[model samples]
Target: MKQPLIIIIRSINFSRVNKERNKRDIERNKRSKMVSSASSSEAKIISQCFVKPKTVSETSKDPYNLSPMDHVMLSFQYIQKGLLFLKPSDGAIKPQDFMETLLQKLKDSLATALVHFYLLSGRLSTSVTDDASSYSVFVDCNNSSGAGFIHAKSDLSVGDIVGSKYVPLVVQSFFDHHNEVKAKVTELVDGVFVGLSMNHSIGDGVSFWHFFNSLSEIFSSQETIDNNIKLFCLKNPPILRQVSTGSVYSLPFSESPKSNPQFQTQVLQERMLHFSSEAVRSLKSKANQESGTTTMISSLQSLTAFIWRSITRARKLQSDQETTCRFVADSRPRMVPPLPMNYFGVYISLVKTTAKVGNLLENEFGWAASKLHHVVVEHTGEKICSEMKRRFNPPCALPSETFYDPTIVHMGNSPRYDNYGCQFGMGKAVAVRSGNNDKYDGKVSAYPGREGGGSIDLEVCLLPEFMEALESDQEFMSPVSPSSG
Candidate 1:
């Protein structure tokens, strides 16, 4: 009887062990299946795709006339380009999520944005009235055409483009809009690049930023289903005021059309130079001290002065040679009655200051600052309005003589745009750039620094030789943070 009982106990123990092993095996198989499923989902990569408006509006087809200012800008049929924003991959958000949900969200938001910016949905056309001599170009807002939206995957990483020595031409290619305002999204290995290519005739930098801000605002408010997207609508929408016949500046338009001048085919190199708040403050103080003036110079003025002087010196131009610094100042506040902040048009005037290379390089920093300040101050409301009244006209173009010259440095964009704040659910852009605008030698684009706090990023382009000289200048390089390059 004792032997039989011991055998029974052993049998019971064996059965219990068998049960536990079976349970463990089931769980292991379940986990393996889950892991395999996740791997398969993650492996799904969207190599290329196109996004179009989910819904089209009837008004999109309505014919819209270009503002006089718009006509004036048409002469520059080239693309006004910029990196809309770029954010690194969020660890919490998987690549699959980006490929699936994020892309759809972007499309939906963009479709909504186009509803308000209807002009972008249309194509350009020219119409001639009974007077054969007069011809007008207008945006055919009839929603027959849609803004371009492209999604592409690239092996290149974000670091390979941003903060690199040159603007990535491959990345810029993503913004090819065929002369229309278009947006693109390209996925890199570790991050994403968003870019915009708008026709220069459509708007200026401020208008461009406003449109982008509106798009971002709509995109971020997605959680609130009932949220209304607001845009500029006025009882008396601002008109492109006519120019008086007696204008100080000549009408830039030509009766005979001419091909756009192509600059030297030599490749231009772009370099991004960073100035921290501390560095900017030091430069400003140095300028004030050197000028021995009680009046304080602004950060923009000080930095512009320093960069102008540095470029002049780096180029090693003749002492008697003349160098011009040209930048567009916003004319909104300078209008008789300040234009509404939402006025959707180009309200800017070109302010050009010229100096002998030797005098500019030899003068105290304050002198250069003073020169910039004077040009800015002189463009008061009365002055800008007076100038606009004089030169404003329809079917006008920029003067042929106004072609870009290596001796002239053109400043584009501004630090005040707050580009770093242009976040789209993903974190803020690690870096922002003015895309192909940097293709031209002697072109400089400025953006607020990533760290905020009054820092500035100067995207400077020059001939390879001048860039080499500027990069090596100890005094010029002193203000540039090593991490920025």
Candidate 2:
């Protein structure tokens, strides 16, 4: 038996829901195109369409400019997430009937949800400065095409996917994308797969989950409060534009840099390892006690340090070679005055901590963790704003080390997202999966364990050899909650 793997997929979808049988089919065709599948067993897009908001808002009609933070992440791949659910209990709803109900509910609710998240339905535009030194990006709200929604089915069961040792290729290139925000629902033999994907530039994980939750909330509410628009008071309406002041402002990209060929060609193995709350606490306590500090090191910092050492050893890098760890910190609270929770789009600061592989491997776990803690602390709102002015006066091209460098390890996503809360009136999701949108070697996406209680699942991507070595490392493996696979 293998331990249940819960993937932290970062994905999104929306569209109009009209009940005219023939016209719905015709309109679906006119609004979106059908995608072809490679094989009979693989998932196929039966229908596709762009989803727009039900109510038009004059406030959202203007072209919305993306903030500098958004520009900084324009080159990154889209965030893709998926949730899995067993069919409804009683098996009363036939597959076709259940799917039809789900499809309509999602579409109708997504349209309502889009009223609040207008940017999802819009297109991204970029323009170069007259000096030809830089460019700016914005969302063309007026020419909206709506978010992408696709209905697909496959023969794969939960076991066929989660039971595999590695991510199957079929799940990697499952859907074709056209809109900035894309979504898919694939009905498996034993369960349903709901996926959401969005351009990284549009938002970070915070915004992504918020929009997704809103859609799910709307969809689920249809059973009772179906038409009570006033009842769906947005807890925190999203503020899409940058609201905080900065010392200086400039875009991060010299140009929207093309996708890295290295990332595309790289062969990586992904493994999701679970660490219980107790293990994390023990790791933290031991790290702090060893460092002779009581309060400075956090659970995440300690775990990160532990993994850093483990992976460096696994890689067998030379003592003198540099090993860099880069992770994101929320910039909203770091903003000069601190933006509220509803602040949307990209507002994140990437912090990097580097050390010689030998130094990291030889040092006590506390030493490496202290470096990560200090680097993250130094990345204050003031420093973040100042970095903007310094990074691109004349537009400095992004260094290869920023992303494609082999010596780099990037830790992303948080374990706090309400991933399991995406219930669509079918009770709750039994599992979660991350799609292969921007996967690469040395990437770790963290998510809250499905069983909760401070448990965390790190979906780590490494070369096949690296993964094997990592799994065998006693120091790292000891803390991992065992799985059957």
Candidate 3:
């Protein structure tokens, strides 16, 4: 494959001053441990309930056509996962009391949130046209479906999972389906762990966080006449504009006769690397220095560039080989009029940056960071709309094929999303994670840390050999501490 041209390049020397600065940042982030080690305590299922809306209007009973973006997402056929861990309240509340109160609040707030966001409670269905040859997939908002809620109890404490080397595998069982809201609340000796799994087809990360924030708002609001009345009034009501299907892209669907042949033969390892706020600052500073420009580098851009270089070096690809970095950018702000904050559907576009393996590995970190920044800056409102209009053209195949290519890296999620702010009456979460089973080699997930600082946690998956080399690479490991799973 032909590599994309480098848009910009500026060089600066790496000196002792940069090394000393990084060393100081690392020391500032170290803290003493306060929790016991992971125990053998297993979370036992207590109860399961289908949480339905309190009221479904007649207008809500009708099925709606899927937006053009939704149709595009239907091709992926994958569900996204999110897990949040909360410490116990600071009072003298009993475990039983806390569990009962938390479950009730969750159920009530979920029901209220579904009233405005009813599509989440619906199912994905396909209908044949009059010709019998054509079909369309849409959301059935008949209110016949509901989100799944599960309550469980665990003997482990909050410390066992938070900051632990590996996240507990029990977190995967929380959600039953992608469309359905699957939440598992495990009662710990001194805290509670909440896990949520959602279908990616329904909405992207922005929409997911909007719903979560609304749910938290409803839960935290005091019960009163005015508050109850305002609960149904949304700040930004969801508006489904008529999307032209002609502009939407369609991918060929081909079924492989061989079953699980390729996946069964491969080995992938998932690991979490925690980057402190100071570490991110250090990286941003180093990246800026390398650029030899006054242009400020974002934490995401700098870290991504650093990781991409580390991976390329670890994989040890040929100098002439081509490599690509892919990441998703939110399209709402890039749209002409800009979509509303509450516009709840897939509103994201993929960004792919490619370069020769030799150039990428031999260049200063600023070159990679500048390339990433250019990609983001190039996708303006007009450009994104134009791209959407031309979606029917042959889609780029590099990103989807990255999982099989050791030279390709795909980044997922963003630290811009305030995932840690998903408080449900309790204080902020101690930690948040993507489910264990959601990991894929050559893919990386990034999220804001729970420490309220500007830190980031990178959930990385790679082939065993590549991961081993990455862990030992001094430059990459300098600012990161790995959490093995």
| TM-score per candidate | 0.79, 0.84, 0.81
Report the number of the highest-lDDT candidate: 2
* lDDT for 244 (candidate 1): 38
Q: Write the per-residue lDDT of candidate 2 for residues 60-177, one digit (tens) a residue.
A: 7765666555655666667878777777658777766877887888888777788888778777776566787665666766776677777776655665555555544446534434
Q: What's model 1's overall lDDT?
A: 0.62
Q: Which residues of candidate 3, in runs, are more than 4 Å off?
A: 1-44, 77-79, 87-91, 177-181, 222-231, 234-262, 292-296, 393-404, 436-438, 481-485
Model 1, residue pairs in steric clash: 60-141, 60-142, 60-143, 61-142, 61-143, 334-381
Alpha-carbon lDDT of model 3: 0.63
Query: Could you tell me how far off, in angstroms, the CA of residue 119 lies in candidate 1 after the best superposition?
Result: 1.6
Every candidate's lDDT: 0.62, 0.69, 0.63
- In the range 168-228, model 1's lDDT, one tens digit per residue, is 4444444542454556666555556566666666667776777677766766777775535
Better of 1 and 3 by lDDT: 3
What is the RMSD of candidate 1?
Answer: 17.3
Best by TM-score: 2
